[model samples]
Target: MISSVLVANRGEIARRVFRTARRMGIATVAVYSEADADAPHVAEADQAVLIGPAAARESYLVADKIIAAARATGAEAIHPGYGFLSENAAFAEAVIAAGLVWIGPPPAAILAMGLKDAAKALMIEAGVPVTPGYLGEDQSLARLQAEADAIGYPVLIKAVAGGGGKGMRKVDAAAGFAEALASCQREAAASFGDDKVLIEKYVTRPRHIEVQIFGDAHGEVVHLFERDCSLQRRHQKVIEEAPAPGMSAEARAAVTSAAVKAAKAVNYRGAGTVEFIADASEGLRPDRIWFMEMNTRLQVEHPVTEAVTGVDLVEWQFRVASGEPLPLRQDEITLNGHALEARLYAENPAGGFLPSIGVLEHFRMPAGIRVDSAVEEGDEVSPHYDPMIAKLIAHAPTREGASDRLAQACAEVEVWPVKTNAGFLARCLDHADFIAGDVDTGFIGARLDALAATPEPSDEALMVAAAAALGDQDGPATPWRDLTGFRLNAAPETTLRLYLDGRPVLASLPQGDVEADVLITGDEVIVFEAGEAYAFSARAPIADLDEAAGDGQIRSPMPGKVVAVSVSVGDTVTRGQVLMTLEAMKMEHGLTAPFDGEVEALLVSAGDQVSEGVSLARLKAAA
Candidate 1:
């Protein structure tokens, strides 16, 4: 048995592994970068080590540093908790070379399933069904275009080494194939150091279903059911649950058996997920599902599996890595209640889903659920990392009950300053289609506008903010006496001027005890409702003298580096034309012209680091 373990990752995954390690009476180690010096995972570990700088390449992705840190801390084993080096075959080899137990699959298995093209070929050979695609060795532009033409329109260009929605794009026609291919290759080169790509037939009305499979060194593999990650936005999963809705026993058996077969083919060990794409146009059927790719590590949505299976997956990893057999036989494992997990990201959904970076002044998760988080109140959400703040999971005896409980939990979220997607997630959970279990990967993209729309604060919320503003005023010793201009004969109404998102709004609050949860921070009165925090200020709005009709100042939406400056001064541009692209929070945001105009000034160039609100260009109306 391993006495000490080092988690070669950060954020919630690191804390997750540490929790399981501590419960098993094992010592835990944590490795962090300068940016994460004060991260909760570091403080929670028995031993901590500084690996490198903030950028992931210099820190978390540097496998040598990870192994050296584990050695320095006397860690007997290394648990790569997904991302970074988790699926790096060479990294796994290096860990074993350094006499450290690797809490994952063997290097051969990782390499076997590392690239999408190779993995698909192997799956097809192993009798596991795969999506129809071109998995050739040719990497020329003409060759890929020809393949796309052969595969027909609506083809998908995927980075052979891609994961997490990066380095992937869907082209609906041949006219857009070249541009999408270039963009996909660029992202692939940057993210995976490999520009090689493959073409696949894009599945219309697709539902992402993946089976959780575990194997042991003793040559046994068992699946822990399947998860439906159909609720997605821009190909990134938002909400996930198990077992997939509308999944019949025949479909489940086919997918799960295929997953186990895939694992056995590679002699896989430990926890791995075999992802599949199902054509949901006619509901789930065994023949309609085909293999997508394999994620050879613990998934972000593994908590839902744990909640349903009553299994400690991390503990299983430790035991399996210690040369143990399977913990339970295939017939012994069983699924319990339905579980749902929503990823709470620090982002503004209505504002193009831009990542929000700042100190989390107020952070509170809903009660009566499982919350796996890394940051706490007052922690800074750095732009150098993923924007996800936490994962909230809820389980109930039935799917409807679980959905209602999870929706309520999301609605009860309380976060301030750092914007979160709690309201957006709650909206998705409560959507009529979602309630009826009619979901697919396109669910969120189709309803983004309605789901991400900024909600109008209820009259009750306005009243609470108004009361909080009155309470902040001086000369009021108690809430009863704080109501200024209160008239006992006129229903004791007090009118106050408040600013909502910099726009002035008039609100009236009753004199009697106003019941609402409100926080008065600095000059802002924040009211929480339906998982949204509305900040209202009693202070008057400031006038911007430079602001005028049809103003065209192109500003950075968030702190990031300019990737491509597409315009020059004096260039005439039309409304919706791309001005430049900003890379921030691991995603690119394109700055576009607000109206037809001439580029008056170019303030920044490509590769220049910029802060939020920094003006990049200026446009003047065309003559």
Candidate 2:
């Protein structure tokens, strides 16, 4: 029996695995890098061990280091949370060879499904449906181009070992195929250390659905229905839910069976996910479903499956690792209700979704909802790791109710200092297409303009701000009243300027209670009147206001080393023009000019390590 387990990853997944292990009376151990020394996962475990330096390649992905940590802590098993080295076949082999139980599928299973091209071929041989495309051995530029031509336009060039859309691109016309392939290859090489790619037909308006399958050493296997992960941004899932919104019974059954067959083919043990792409333009059908790939480890979106199925998948992983038979039969497993999960990322939605890093000053999530977070209020969102702060999940009797409850929970969640995607996620839930369950992978891209519309401040809210600002000073009489000013016949109208979402707006208050004209210098507002004016009192900086505005310089969006400088002092640039690029979290974000103006100063240069909100450049006001 496996008495102790070591989680070989960091953050929420480690915390999640520890929770399950503790429930089963199994001791849990945690391994951390230098940067994650104070991370919550390390503190949550029964024992902790330091592996190596801060870089992932030095710590988390160092198989030998993780194994040594497990050995030092006397852990009998290792659970590799997804990403890093979870799907690494050699890592699994090393763990088993070290006389530790590998709490995942066999290495053979991982090898079978690790490569997308290989997985597709295996699935086809196993009688599973696969999309028509090229999975040939030749990877020459000419060969791939020919495949694209034969498959027609709108082909998707994808890395054979890719996930999270890191190494994927869609070409709408043959003219852009070569450039897209080059870009995809570069990203694939950087992210996965493998540049080999494959081409497939890009299904327009496709729904991403995947089945959760669990297997045991005794040859028992069962499917846990399906989850819809179609709502995506930049090909990364933002929202996921169980018992997909508009799934047909026949389609669900077919996919579930195929998932079980896929697991059986690989002699898979423990938990795995079989992903499928469904043509949603015509609605879901059994014939429309095609195999995508399989995640050989526990998934980040597994909470929804647990909520609806009433099963702790982590517990099952431990049980199977202990050489136990399947806990429940296929007939006993059933979906109870609807469940939804929203990823709370430390990213700014209005600012191109660039990852935001800072010390979370205040973190408050709703009480009733399930929150799986890896960091605390005082914890820092480092540039070396993933930007996801937490996962908020809600379960209800129906899909609409679950979505509504999740939205309410998110609205109440407050995380100060660091900009988050909370507001944007709430907007997505309230979106018409999403609420109606008529969304696809292209939902965010299609509605980018509409969804990014900024909210307007209400009269009451503005009044509150003005009142707070006015009450802060020490004056004989009220600022709006006549005491210091000389003339009684005419009261002076004061002009107040404030920044909202990085843009300036002017408020003009007349002497009396009559309405005043307000000028919004930015784009139009959809939810409220942007330029409408109201009676003013004063203004004060609230907790939500950007603290960096007082610094008089534009800061980097995330923690990263500056890669390039586009301009120096006295150079004029327009809004949306690239200022510099910061590479972090395995991605590069271009810092852009906030407004059209002359560059006053450049604070940093290439190769300088900068934190989020560190001043990088300054823009002088336009004449």
Candidate 3:
């Protein structure tokens, strides 16, 4: 057995791997950047090392630093949890060269399936069904356009080396092909360092189903069932489930068998996922589903499979990497109950899913469900990493029951001030279409209005905030502090003015001393109502913040690096014209002109990092 393991990742996945490693009595090692020095994963590990600075390129992505860290710690093996160096074939080879056990598939397997263009060819030779598209080595624009036209309209332009939807675009017609190609190529180069791309037929109604396959050094591979990850936004998965909803027995058998074949063909070992896109325009049929890509490491949604099969995949990885054989045969793995996993992101769904950065003033987990998280109170969510805060997983005897439980769990979330998609996720799990298994890749996009609708703050929350403001958490203070800022020396007013959800709400408070489940922190108060907490600040409404902004100014919404400046000084632009694009939290946000105008001043250039509310450009207002 492996005596020690060093996790070469950060956040929740590292904490998750440490949990299993601790349970097995193995010493856990953690490598962290300066930004993650206070992270939970570092504290949980038996030994820790500082690799580099906060930037991933300077830290986590640097292979030599990781290798040196492992060597100094005398770690027997390294676990590249999910992202970072997990799929880097060269990194795997380097780990092996350093005389460290790489707890992942062989470099040969990663190389075989790392690139989509090459992987598809191998899958085809292995007799696995692949999506029909052009994987030819033609680098000309005319050739790609011709292939798109031949494949018919609405084809997908995807980076050959892409995953996570970073370098993918959907083009509906020839008129948009040129711009789409350029944008796709640019993003591809930025994300994967590869400008090469391939065109595919985009399935309008697709259900993303993937089989969890594991193999050992003995060449025995077994399928651990499948997960339906169709509930997605911006091409990223939001919700995932085990034993895909409404999966026919025959279809399941066919797909799982094909996934196993793909794994065996590459002589795969450890945990891998063979993702397939099923055309649900009609229904899931064996012939309609095709292999999309293969993830050569543990997936983010692996918990659902574990919940159903009662298997600990990380433990399986540890065992396999320790020269162990397959834990169970294909027939031994049986699905028990339905399970659902919802990814909770620190993003505003109502605000078009714009990711937010903040310090978690208060963070509380709900009861009666499993939650995997890495954040706590006072921790900062920087603009340098993925915005996903945690994952909420629920399991029940049936699919409908599992969905209901997951919705309640989301409702019980009590994060304060930091905007989250909890309400949005609750709605997704409870939606009629989602409950009835009538979902496709476009399900969330089609019903986004209802799903993203922000609910009005209830009166209960207002009173609770009022309680906190009155110093009720500390027995209503000596006198009473209310909207008037009257101390306990002065009698407090019955009504308190509070800024709740960006508007003033007069909340009636109890006279004299009062008590409530609340806390006053800084300029804000967190009030607990029915197990969920709401943040409020009781004071005279500050004059409207947006009132100072003049027309025709394009401002950056958040602190980010200016990736592109599309307009120069004196350039005429129309309303809704994109002036600049800001890259924050690994996402690009465009700053557009408010009306038709001429660019008056360009304040920033490409690659300049700017702060929130800073004007990137000023435009002459239209007469």
Candidate 4:
């Protein structure tokens, strides 16, 4: 039996593993970077070890350091909680070589399924259906172009080692095939250190379905059913649920069998996910499903699989690592109802979903739902990691009930100071199309304009703001009286400037009415009358309000090291021109100018570490 285990990852996954391990009487160890010294994962562990600096390359990606931490902590095994080096065959090999049990599939299985082209070949040999594509080893540009032509138009160019849609492109026309291939190759090389790619026939209007499979050392494997992750952004899953909606009995059986075949072919063990793309335009059919990829470790969206199945996947990982056989038979396992999960990110949806970083001054999530988070109130959202604050999951007897409960829970969540996707998620759950289960990968993007639209402040909230401005509370030296300049006889109306959504809004406070006129400069007064004013309060700023706003310059969107600077000082650039690039959370984000302007100053150089909202370049307004 494994007495102690070191989780070789950080953030929510680490916390998640610790929770399960603690319940099973297993001591848990946490490894963290310098930036995560005060992170919640550190607090949740039985022992914490510093791996390295904040950059993932120096910290989580350093397999040797993680191994050393495990050794130092006397951990009997290592649980790689996805991402970083979770699927890295070398890391698994190293852990086994170090005499510590590896709580994942064998290195051979990981190597077999690590590359998409190779995995598809293996799956084909295993009698599993794979999407029609060119998985040949030819690297010549002309050869790929020829293959693309032969495969017909509307083909997908994907990196052999890709996941999360990074080195993938959809070419709708033969004319654009070469350019898309070049772009995909460049990104593939930068992201995965491999530029080898493959082409596949694009499945139009597809639904992403994946099966959860577990294997034991005794050659016993079982399927834990399926998850619908059709709701995506940039090919990254945003929402997921168990027992995919609208799935026919025949289709489910086929997918489950194929998932089992894929795992058995690799002699797999522990938890793994077999992802498939189904042609939903023609409705789900067994023949329409094709293998996408196999995630060799636990997925971030695995909680929903746990919810409906009543299986602790992490506990299973622990048990399977101890050489346990299959605990439950296929006929014994059954789904109960429906469950949904939403990723709550510290990002501003209206601001292009750029990661938001700041101290969570007042973080409060709703009860009666499972919230797996690695941070707490007063925790700082660093740019050194992924901006996901938490994963909120709700389970009910029906999909509609689950969605409705999740929406209500999200509305009651309060995360002040740091902007979040909570409001955006709430809007999505309440969306008519979403409620009716008529959603696709393009749903968020299609309804983005309406989803990101911030609602006007309620009358009650405005009244609270007015009360805060007026100093009505019993206290010494009223600031409102000071603003009125000590007028004795007549109560004077005063104009004051306040910041809202990074812009100035003029508020006029009159003595007679308990409300204020929210005046739009050079426009009209939007009258706001008080309704229920009890639950409203003024929100404090995250940072010092008196600080100058960084010279009105475009800054890095998240905490990251500057990878490149595309523009120089005094360079004339148009609106949306790329100025620089910053990389964080293993993803690259480009910083662009807001409008046509001349670069006035370059504040940061390549390789500089920057925090969120730190100015990278200053742009002078166009004449």
Query: Model 3: how large is the Cα RMSD against the reference?
Result: 3.9
Candidate 2 error regions (>4 Å): 470-556, 561-582, 590-623
Q: Give the winner by lDDT.
A: 1
Scanning candidate 4 in windows of ten residues, the lowest lDDT window is 524-533
**Which whole-number lDDT from 0 to 100 does residue 521 have in model 4?**
15
Which regions of candidate 3 are displaced past 4 Å?
Answer: 466-497, 506-519, 527-535, 544-546, 572-575
Find the candidate with the highest TM-score and give its number: 1
Q: Give the backbone clash total of model 4.
A: 1
Any residue pairs clashing in model 4, and if so which?
383-559
The lDDT, on a scale of 0 to 1, for candidate 4 is 0.81
Q: How far in Å is the alpha carbon of 579 misplaced in model 4? A: 4.3
**Per-residue lDDT value at 303 in model 1:** 97
lDDT per residue as tens, model 2, 1-623: 68999999999999999998898899999999999999999999999999989889889989999999999989999999989999999999999999999999999999999999999999999999999999999999999999999999889999998888788989999898987787688778767889999999999879999999999998888999999999998788999999898888888889999999989999999999999999998899999999999999999999999999999999999988999988889999998989999999988776688777778755667779899998887898887988898999999999999999998877666665567788778788878889999989999899886665545776433433333333334444332221111122223555555445445556543454432222211121111122111222233334534444533367876667775676889987898878876778877677887778888889999779997668898887577
Regions of candidate 4 where Cα sits further than 4 Å from its true position: 140-146, 149-153, 171-191, 471-499, 502-553, 564-574, 577-579, 596-623
Candidate 2 at residue 396, lDDT?
Answer: 97
**Candidates by TM-score, descending order:** 1, 3, 4, 2
Can you list the residue pairs that collide in candidate 3?
Answer: 479-488, 480-488
Q: Model 4, residue 161: displacement in angstroms?
A: 2.1
lDDT over C-alpha atoms for residue 328 of model 1: 93
